[model samples]
Target: MISESTPLAAVEQAMQALLDDVVPLASESVALGEATGRVLAEAVEATMDVPPFDNSAMDGYALHHSDAGHTLPIIGRVAAGDSPLALERGTCARIFTGGALPEGADCVVMQEKACVTDGHATLPGDVPEGDNVRRRGRDVAQGSQLLGAGMRLDAAALGHLAAQGIDKVQVRCKPRVALLSTGDEIIEPGKPLASGQIYNSNRPMLVALLEGFGADVIHIQHVPDNAEDTRRCLREAALAADIVVSTGGVSVGEEDHVKAALEALGELNLWRLAIRPGKPLALGRLPGGDGQLTRFVGLPGNPVSGYVGAWLFLRPLLGAMQGCTAMAELPRLWATSTFGTSTGPRQHYMRVRLDFSREGIQAHAFTDQNSGVLSSCVGADALAVVPPHSQVAQGDLLECLWLKA
Candidate 1:
């Protein structure tokens, strides 16, 4: 329902509509060693307490608090992983870091605070009870929830699982993506180009983006301007992929036949957006196997346009398909603008380099904001947002989306 003049909010709503139809993939069991970056499909609970037993937190003399300020006999040593011994009421135990505390000991005096002689140790004055003791279950308690569903398993999570003796986990399957590029004037990279022909840059860029986003690229195809051929390719892609992303041939030109082929195969939910650098975007659903619907995203041919469209549409769609609904909207934080801008009817997402100052993060827009100028995106860390029919002066606060996000 959006056109080129629609607001960014309306475009976001249309994008969400397409995502609402996607279903998360089924879960499968994976070894803990291979679970990094995979989405957790089930909540994980700790079977045992971290630091399962009460132990010493440092290398010190373990003794009863009442024995403080007294030169006590060093009856035994309890190093880490060694069996704990019972301490005499007036004696101490030589314990190393992470060592077990003796049963009769109620406190630990750090080695620096205690004077150790040939066979005895002198404790500090008035040492408190429970000093230098790491209590059992102080970290993770038994039966406590460790990780939640839909969370990505990172290095920290993996270490936590290893501490709990977990060897396997259940994770969501990666979505299968079909990538296509169209245009008679476009040729594949690494091949000689004819006169008036340009190499296809959007496909490689999109494929890399999809890989970094963690989706599995199932097929990569290039099609010409033929309508019948486009329709046939669409059907085959929908049958084989959970989502299809294509670049070029979705606009109003006579050679643009992707929209028509999509309309014939299924339903078109969105055809345009109100954002600069990428206004010719198409979103739809195609008939899939087993009565499921395969999502489709058509981005403009220009490299900059395709990049913007990917961030605005394809990323959110992939997130939704993986049950990450919170990623439907990008974070928009305020930043001071180093330069001014005059906007027109459509919303503008200007590439800018971010600099941190005493005031805060500042956005500096590139001199060239043209859609076809892909080089402008280099070294830019964020996209500074400019609303329609608006103007701003230098030092004005503007909202921006971080590129790394």
Candidate 2:
């Protein structure tokens, strides 16, 4: 393929290659205690109705709607988890919150609204029909699926499941990922650095990024600029993980050994993207001597490039494995630019801070967006995607994606 194709073409190639190979991980049944942050491997349907029976919504007198605005004698008491009892005719029951209403009661008056004295409650105002009563199946009906097979389990989901007496769930096994960084100039943090050595921030950031995306970050390390060492590292990554993510040394620069190592181990395609911060991306399969294959992505070492590539690539990769349709999609919006801009042949994703101003959503660059600058990403709110060869005046429509908080 010619190197001068459009950016979308390159993105499509990389995305297609990844999509063709990302098989779903194994399935596991786990108690709800550990289901948080795990993807659902199967749908969860409510086997029993929520609330189980007609219950009071407030601590008050449970009475018939016909007794509204009438003073009825409280003859029985019902608290939460108690058996429902019959309420005598022209009588009411003093009920506590979440307590089942008496068999003849259909509504509840709030405690503050009804004056009670010695087993008698005077209900005065016109109470709406069935006021403050939660009927069976109000929260979730039996046989209705509340969560799907591929949904991400969140707090609300767990609460819903608990309401229906579900204490366990089946969830997808988290994908195992191995992270590596290539370059002789990179070193471990907290160690003495010689000249031209920088602390390895990419490993930490990438590991966090993978974990946040639902992948179990298994192994992480830095490989030197030697081809043999890089090859050995790739072998370990491919053997121990379903996907290998590495930064730096994919370009044509001397001492860049990652590309050669990948070629020696498997089939590789290097992409020249039209996006700023990250343009040189290597994507393909790692074929082992035993004929096993694993996916690999080689991203630029520049912090912004590495970060963006993860968003644009790693997100989709893991999202496909989980079967979430929306997770892989790029979020785009028309943001009002605070400054004029022009673009070269490459598409530019300018780090921006956004605010709601007089002209509505106003966006300005985070800093002088040199691809190598890392601090500008600290408070970035969005990315203004400037199209190739396009010019925009101040206050013009700029497409942007909101950064995850």
| C-alpha RMSD values across all candidates | 2.5, 2.4
Off by over 4 Å in 2: 1-9, 288-291, 356-359
Q: Residue 231 in candidate 2 has what lDDT?
A: 94
For residue 176, what is the lDDT in candidate 2? 78
Residue-level lDDT tens digits of model 2 in 92-190: 888999999888888899889888777778887677778999999897889898888788888998888788777888887887788998888898889
lDDT of 1 by residue, 1-405 (tens): 434464343565666766775677888898999887777878899999988887899998999999999999999989999998788898999999888788989889999988878898977788888999998889899999998887777799999999999899988887899999999999997999899999888888898878656688999999888999999889999999999889998888989999999988898888877778787888888998899889988888888999888877777777766665545667777899999898888789999988887979888899998988888877878888898888989999999987685
Rate residue 101 of model 1 by lDDT.
81
Candidate 2: what lDDT?
A: 0.82
Query: Looking at model 1, which ten-residue stretch has the lowest summed lDDT?
Result: 1-10
TM-score of 1: 0.91
Off by over 4 Å in 1: 1-9
Which residue pairs in model 2 clash with each other? none
